[model samples]
Target: MSRPNPAVFIAFLVAVIVVLGSVTLAKGGFYLAKHEGDTLHLLQILFRMASGEWPHLDFMTPIGLLAFAPVVLFLNLGLGVGISILLSQVLLAFILLPAVFWAGMSRLPRRAAYLFGLSVLVLVMALVHGETERSVSISMHYNRWAWAVSYVVIVLAVLPPREIRNDVLDGLIIGVGLAFLALCKVTYFAAFLVPVVVGLLANGNTKALRGALASGLAVALIVSVFATLDFWVAYLNDLREVSASTVRPAPGFGLRTIVMAPAYLGASAVALGAIILLRQAGEMTLGLALLLLAPGFIYVTWQNFGNDPQWLMLLAVLLLVPEVRPELRNSFGWPLAQALGVAAAIAIAFAAPSMLNLAYSPFRHLSLDPADYQPILVRNPEHHDLQVREIRANRVDGVVALDVPGSGLEDRVGKAKRDEERVSFQGTPLPYCELQMGIVAWFEAIVTDLEQNGFAEGRRVFVADLFMGHWMFSSLDRLEHGAPWYYGGLPGIDSADYLLVPLCPTSLSVRKDILETIEESGIAVTEVRKAPLYWLYSFDRDG
Candidate 1:
């Protein structure tokens, strides 16, 4: 019965604050600063779910709907979109910061733990606060959560409990993590699952193996029951979107990783090489490093643009953990930790400049007047109708005859605009990027003109543009006659009577083949005409 150290307690609190505070403050750096903001359309999906419209069979998404748990709860609790996101972030930070702190404290001295935690936190923040090609403006939560939980799983697997109660709890934790990965995104699940299973097998821990197997099966069974109720065929079909390589760039490693992560790759290899070639293989550190890095290194090669440094920072820390224990501590491991830390620092330093520029670039934007950054609805009351170019008409006698252009999205939403427009709206809390805003404004004027001149929303309209499709869904979620547009959007474009297609930038961004197919569709084309930015077309199947 020894008394705890007061100094260590104070140090722990300070370390947690420093680590957590920095991450919290950095959220402002990019809470919604990107060109398109956080417009992955999760909130829209949640809105549909709250209103009793399930995706897959109702809508189509390559991303799993199970990822919307936070939003679903928020919607149920009646939280506004803004509040929901903030709460979501706060929840994530609360969970993530402690996990990071514990990992640092587990292996290192108190002072060293603080430093390790700070470094890892910064790396994670920087990774989230910017855009990567692979992430495509995703707020690094997906990557960070998966990494954080995977680290916890690794620690648990390496140090299983002796007590039955503790062992069961650990198994549950791993099970929930795997379940979250399964729902959040499949790639993340695969990333950890492959390495972890191999690591456990290599270690030959049969008890641990059985526990992990049971955990996975339990989660699978639960998900299976729900998916069966939700329509397994639709869920399976929705998965096809990830395989649409032509639509989005393929991620993961190759020769490019060699060029991108030379330092990290070289350093990781050397760490593994030291144990094997130098014959200090008591802890299987190199084997574990190999298992972790085998997939991770390649993934990082193309992860979030180039030089997967920030993520590498956390990965290096995780790989270094097993070697940091008092008994296991060796001549090889300490130096390896320091080397990986240096490598991470060096990598983060290189990648910081571009993202930093983007984050602060809104202030320096030259083209738009300051008024454009103000809330559009304040400037124009009809902005909802204007931005979307159509509204659902209200009819009392079962024949709604109001002249609303599109009825899907609300006027209060700034999410209607294009990516470029949203970027231009930087510093304004709106999600529309610069490109997106410009397109929205243009469509408002153009579509208003055409409708006034006699064009109208027919029984059905095909939104060829992906964002356009989302705009349509944010307003309405009709699935009665839906069919597959592609794989990522609501599956009902071909069933429509009229086709609304934007050319060049918007269409080009959707999918190359889709734009090409629309251009070659040979349907009745009403030339709403073209501009320098894009060509607007309205096609009629009846004609």
Candidate 2:
């Protein structure tokens, strides 16, 4: 690494404190603009953890424990979930501060290093998931945190130090970053693991490899000691179950589209061009490492919900740092340095929208009028700080296809012989109904009705739909072994006293899958009651 710049590091620290503090002070509470469903799912995990339950053992989820651990820690300390979230991001930034500092100071110029640190911190602290959207929400926050770690890891691995070299620090950063990925989101670990190792080796940083291995192992040992060795088995089982389940395999576009679709093709071209330019500039080792990382980059983007190519900033940074001679030129006779600069600009252009959105979110949150929002977890007045739009919490909306038989719309749409594909429960054909919004209202109403009907506190009713966030709002007990968001295979069903099937489900496909699976299992269930919201059926455990 180059001689460390104290001024740059100090400036970065000040920026972190000022930015995060300003946002926290501005909101006075956490405010969400959208994605209430995701927030509720997060609350379920946090609620369970706060209640002394363990993930994988007490609930089913493919997400790793570290994803929720930081926030849960603050929650257990008596902070509201909203502040817990903000504090967790602050904690993550500090946890990663040394690595970001080392990587930035080692590879980048003073200004670039400061920007690098600031960017990573902004991503970690941003209230919204990445996109061009101006609205703020803490949806898919773990994804953002994983991407921040990835940015640090890639920079550290791909760039050799300019002058100073601390092999121990380098290895520890790589190891801790990778271990965090494994414990927070395994998809990132699986995607970048090989490439990171190859990058370190290709750069001839062999001395750091042993430290990396030791650090990673040490992290694993600690987790096993606390969460127990069986945690790995349960974790893997959740992963395997989700992998096999047809529900929500991908959040947005498919893998192929993420790789080569029109929206993504330009970024792919920029990455390839950067790789080739690095090779042409005679930086063969870095080029090869980047080439290997390209696929992993695409895989991570495909796995994330919005498919935001957050790695573009890292690409830009890498392009800026190569010390190629001024005279070097590619086949087009374009000066290699300028070519790299132009490529970097294009990468920045592709990433600008999301980056700007992330950087500006805290300030935007400051401008929101508090009178417009309401507490999401209505029963938990202590968590009144976590707020959402009142309309979103109260107004329910759904979409149902028109079934005008005489109009022949069904036939024209190829639904004439849809019987084989129709969703049915107990020999009854279900309509095409899907809830689109007001998830808070949906769950709150169900729980309220359930309590009023004498199916009160301590009851564990498994909703036959995608999300089971019922316990977060009411006195009802969280379903043992239940999934916050259903990935499939009827998790927690055996432990459920009653199955509540929503007439209009959040995901019709998930409801269909769950009901079919239940029927195949031959679990006898008799109707208990029916309401406008859902049908409650008690399991005939003896039968």
lDDT for model 1: 0.44
The residue pairs that clash in candidate 2, if any, are 1-161, 1-164
TM-score each candidate: 0.64, 0.96
Q: Mind giving the per-residue lDDT tens digits that candidate 2 earns over 405-480?
A: 7765755556444444359788766777788989898988888999999885788888888888887777777777
lDDT of each: 0.44, 0.85
Candidate 1 residues 1-543, lDDT tens each?
Answer: 122233564466455445444443332322232323124344346556667666676766555555565556665776554335434544554555544444443334344345445543333333243334322122434554454455555544543222222444445556666766666666566666766566556655555666767877787777668656555577666676546534544433444555446645554554444334222425464355455645554553444333343343433434333333234334655554444445435544544554343233323322223222322122233222111111111110111112234755455345433432222111222221123334334434434443444443333445444543233322223334243234344356565544444432343345434434555554454645444433345555563
**Model 1 superposed RMSD (Cα):** 12.0
Q: Give candidate 1 regions above 4 Å deviation.
A: 1-31, 37-43, 95-128, 131-141, 158-165, 203-205, 227-232, 251-281, 300-307, 319-460, 469-490, 507-512, 518-543
